[model samples]
Target: MLAYRHLFHAGNFADVFKHALLTRLLIALGKKDKPFFYLDTHAGIGRYDLNHEWAQKLAEHRDGIARLWERTDIPGPLEPYMACVRAENAGGRLRWYPGSPRIARAFLRPGDRAELTELNRDDANALGKLFDGDRQVHVHLMDGYQALKAFLPPKERRGLVLIDSSFDRAREFARLTDALATAHRRWASGVYALWYPLMDGTAMHAFERGVVATGIRRILKLELSVLPEGWNESLRGCGLLLVNPPYGLEDEARKMLPWLWRTLSEERTGGTEVRWVVPE
Candidate 1:
């Protein structure tokens, strides 16, 4: 959706969570000599300009990454995530933010392929133009979910799929559930990450319970943000459901969350929880 250009939100709290996890997972995927597929559904412009109107208004990063960036004294768990953000900034003045494609590009090694998809025409065109001369990445204008289904079990047999939808459609949650179920059925052993806002606690709980009921094992949840005290309040956090997360992520979350809670949250204090939804 053009309404959500990502330029305005880049390096904000949500991006901090999503990109940090993404960078870490891709890093883990690089461990093996075998090649892997990195799929980004709902990829936005490959990169963003903080000077843009949207970004300049709130400059939300001032409260998010801006707080963490200045400090070299990061906790161990967040070291990898912090490093990812820093490298993307190139120790520069954090004027730009790297989207999924740019973040994926940063870690791509020889033989590793990245497939980025954006349904929005404007964004798709921008994505294409963003890396017009690059050969390692493929920008697809296709529906990301369908494209993901078609590209399952990539030739390399190891892959990661990132589904970060805008959830503009009422049926988006259902569609996401069905799509993830289908993708999981297609590549049971692959790593899958799904992001969703904290729209409604009851609704989200029901959704998660249903997914776990499907018998997908090792479903780990990484949640950040504190619940508002009043019964009625805007959803303040986002979550990542990792279907086949790499080893050490749970441990990493354990150590990383406290520092993030202290730094990124606007409440001065917040909540961060990482645990298995389904027992190992």
Candidate 2:
């Protein structure tokens, strides 16, 4: 299960969908003066080199971040996320891409704190080195699901928890639902963002029902699929379920996701979705 390496898929459309929304959540947290905590479950290396052999094999970024790297019509809400990406590729070349940990770190105020967990030893080491001597960020070499139990109800009590599981194992959707319920029971008020790929209709519907069955309110579901329906060659889409999402996030997604779909989707067959899976 520890074999899931995000480097190969870094900056893909899924990352674009997840991280763009992630920045909004972080920005919403920063709007308050109180310091917040950020816990990244399944945190990979803080940054990725797209030119690496692993990444070059797929060259997925060409279809993802590369599409937006030099766009003249970048949406207003996406500026912060793009700013973080631009900061990493300061040489004006699209050589590097920031993962969720690095993206989250960019928005962390001096008073805020972040805890990142990675099960892969090598990735953990790299992640550790990425934030070495940074007093505000903490990296742990542990299973992300376990980190949820260990770090819930953070001392700050006001923050975001990102559950970006790799879904390499079977029954992962079930595990995510159960974990979200348990975490919500422990920290009902905390913001939670869970990311997942767009699988077949049967699995997707089942996952939706499982989450709704949890009875957690204020759940916002956002999805983007660049490929048309019935095209199952590869991962053509992804979604994020936000529990207790920050105010206006739904509205922001309503505006932002469509633009993303339009810009990223070449076929424009599959589109975007922004709705409440469970209301407050």
Candidate 3:
């Protein structure tokens, strides 16, 4: 849905989960001396002002990044992520938040390149202006799935693709599965990180089955829910499905998810999962 604006939920628990893991993925890619490409499909406005009326409406960040904002006990795996968040709020006041595009740009070495896509005209235009003069970054006003066909198999042969779609439309899960299957076939070696909301059990099972049917291997499934399963709420939790995940990601997630759940869970009811949907 083009009407979906990420600012309303920026810095929420889901953002914490996705952005933290996203930082780890970028870090893993940077481990290699060789330059890597980063494709951010569904890139929102690169930066969000937490004090903006939209963000203040829900004050969601209070439960997400705000909880960890002044903390000194964050695990080692989370340092890079925290550093980025802190960079956005230099005055010690949580005034701004960096979306994936800004976060990805933070880790870009001299040779590294980043491509961000957003379907919303306003967001796409904002994203373009955010990185306007930087030759290393490219912003496109296009559908994320279409971006896969257009930019996959990056010339560098090394990169990570983040598919974060607003699940407001019906059958989005099916569309993501099909598009991913096609993209994987096009560039099987590329690292892909997909974010989705945790839905009903039956729908979740069907989503899993669809991905399984793609016969994609080495899929790492990570999920964190603030509420217990079947919780009747707006959003129980969210998950990140990684394909061809870098080697230490699973272990890193084990540490990060539990800590995030401990800090962000209002009722302390929901849990975390770190497992292989399809092992190598």
Candidate 4:
């Protein structure tokens, strides 16, 4: 998994779906006066240049952010997310893409703090340089799952943890579920967002059952598929599981995901889904 680099897939449809929801979570955390902490496990380079060779290889952004770059009818709930993307591309050219760390840092208040961990030394070094002089953001070169055990129950006692793993290893789904259970026990009140690709039905169901077995409540599951059933050429969809989601996010997702599916789906074949995997 160490060789897995996100640059090849930066700004893809999955990125769009994940980051759009991420911005909403960060916004909700900021509504209260108290400062909160943010932990990004598997943080890639803080930002990406779409023109880079690695990014240009797949040119995934063409079907992702590029589709929304000039659109005027973007839904209101997505404005904050689009603004973050726009900020990375000045002069009206969509050449840059902000990764989760950059997007999260944008929402961090003066008093808020963030900790980003990346196992890849090169990626962690790049991430560290991205926030070199910033006192509020810290970068760590460590395994993301281990980071949960190290940084859980953050001092602020209020924040969000984004576990956006690469899913490059075997048994990653089980690993995510176990890590979630552990982290929840340590910080039950903290908001946790776990992202995963839509694999075969059996694996997906097993993952859902695993999470349910954890007995964690209030978990929201949002998924978007741009390819129709039976289309398996590549990753057709991805899902985000939100633990302790902020109020109204379920409704916001109901509104936001369908619009995304409409705009991003291929031949209008696939669709969106927003539902609670576990209720309070």
Q: What lDDT score belongs to each candidate, Candidate 1 first?
A: 0.80, 0.93, 0.93, 0.95
Query: Which structure among the candidates has the greatest lDDT?
Result: 4
Question: On a 0 to 1 TM-score scale, where does candidate 1 land against the true structure?
Answer: 0.92
Look at candidate 1 and give me any clashing residue pairs: none
lDDT of 2: 0.93
Q: Lowest-scoring 10 consecutive residues by lDDT in candidate 2? A: 1-10
Kindly report which residue stretches of model 3 are placed more than 4 angstroms away from their true locations once superposed: none
Q: Which clashing pairs does model 2 show?
A: none
For model 3, how does the per-residue alpha-carbon lDDT over 123-168 read when each residue is reduced to its tens digit?
A: 9999999999999999999999999999988999999999999898
- TM-score for every candidate vs. truth? 0.92, 0.98, 0.98, 0.99
Query: What lDDT would candidate 3 get against the real structure?
Result: 0.93
TM-score of 2: 0.98
The 10-residue segment of model 3 with minimum total lDDT is: 227-236
Give the residue spans of candidate 2 off by over 4 A.
none
The all-Cα superposition gives candidate 2 an RMSD in Å to the true structure of 0.9
The per-residue C-alpha lDDT of model 2 at residue 63 equals: 88
lDDT of 1 by residue, 66-92 (tens): 787779787765676666666667757
